[model samples]
Target: MQAQIEILASLQTVDREIREQTGRKQRLLEDLRVTERQIQAKKGEIDALSAAWSEREKLRVEKDRVFQDEGKKAMDKRMRMSRIKNAKELQALQREIELMRLGNGELEEELIKIMQEIDAIRAQIQTKESEMAAMQEEWQKKQDELQVEINGIDAAVSEASTRRQTIASQVTGDLISRYELIFSRRGGTAVVEVAGGICQGCYMNVPPQLWNEIIRNEKVHLCPSCQRILFVKPATE
Candidate 1:
């Protein structure tokens, strides 16, 4: 019975450590996911800014083309004005030329505004790109470090798992099965030490007769309240 108790206790300890290490690995994995998302979001921001810049650039280019076309029309009309002989015809031609010139000025003004907007958008895009690059670098470094930590935890968990298997093999089949069942149902604590005639597993007092049996340590006992296998440590002199 003492041998069996020792085996179960050892198994429980390993199981607890495995659970803890597994939890740590899960948390680290979540952190890694969040870190990756942050990098992606930053990249998305830069993409949106770049798209805006491209649209502005296209508008500027189209406006520039229209401005040049209008300027040529104004120049051509001015040259035709000197060939008119009739005063009324000359006045009409001059009015037409002035209208063309005014139209050209409006086009130039609109093109200038478009160019300014394009320049501003370009500057903003450049800044965002730089920021994204830096953010990616920072996140990648963090990911690498986190990965190393996660790998170490995985190795530890694997080692503990092997140890647990070895301990389980040393115990009888029925006892091992009972321990596993209790471990699963009792939150990884299948064995506990009794003290002061109390079922330490549930902090409830055991029957005095049962406590006496547990103290004997000649046979395994279960806490009636919590149904956990109980043992009593010998008094240290």
Candidate 2:
């Protein structure tokens, strides 16, 4: 029975190692997840900026086309003035040409403004793209580092699990099940050592008779307070 208790203790140690490593694996995975999200967010921002740039470019093209068409119409009106023989008709044509020129001036100003806006949008797109590229490079590096750590943790957990299986085979099935239940419920400490008549699991005082029975090492004994399997280390010379 004492030997069985020692086996349970060894199993508990392996289980603790596995649990800690698994937790580290989860944290590493979450870190990778967060890094990936940041990179994706940067990409999304760059895409939106590019879309705006494209829209501005299209607007500039349309505005320039309109300005050119209006200028051509103004030139045609000027040519018509030379064909008119009547003086009043010529004066009227002159006024019509002047109005078209004024309208063209306003359109030209608008086209200039559109071109400036397009230039600014293009510069902004370039800057954002550069930023996204840097973020991707860093993200990849972080991902590689985390993947290596995750792989190491997986290997460690596998090794610990194999050892735990070997140790657990030495104990009875019912005892192993009970220990596992206690291990989970008690936060990875299913077996505890009693020293000076104290229940180490819960730090409560063990009854005198129970302490004596525990010392006999005849069968399994549990701390009344924490219900964990209890044992005492053999006295050393």
Question: Which candidate comes out best when scored by lDDT?
Answer: 2
Worst 10 contiguous positions by lDDT, candidate 2? 42-51
Off by over 4 Å in 1: 181-187, 197-228
- Give residue 223's lDDT in candidate 2 (0 to 100): 93
Candidate 2 lDDT, tens digit per residue, 1-237? 888999999999999999999989888889878878887887788788778878878888888888889888888888888799999999998988889888888988888887888788788778878887887788789888988888899999999989988999999859999999999999999999999999888999999999999999988899998999999999888
lDDT for model 1 comes to 0.85
lDDT by candidate, in order shown: 0.85, 0.89
Per-residue accuracy of model 1 over 1-237 as CA lDDT, tens digit each:
888898899899999999889988888889778877877887787788778878878887887888888778777877877787789998988898888788878878888887787788778778877877787787788788988998899899999989988988899858888888998999889999888888778999989999888877777788999999999876899
Candidate 1 TM-score, true structure as reference: 0.79
Give me candidate 2's TM-score against the actual structure: 0.83
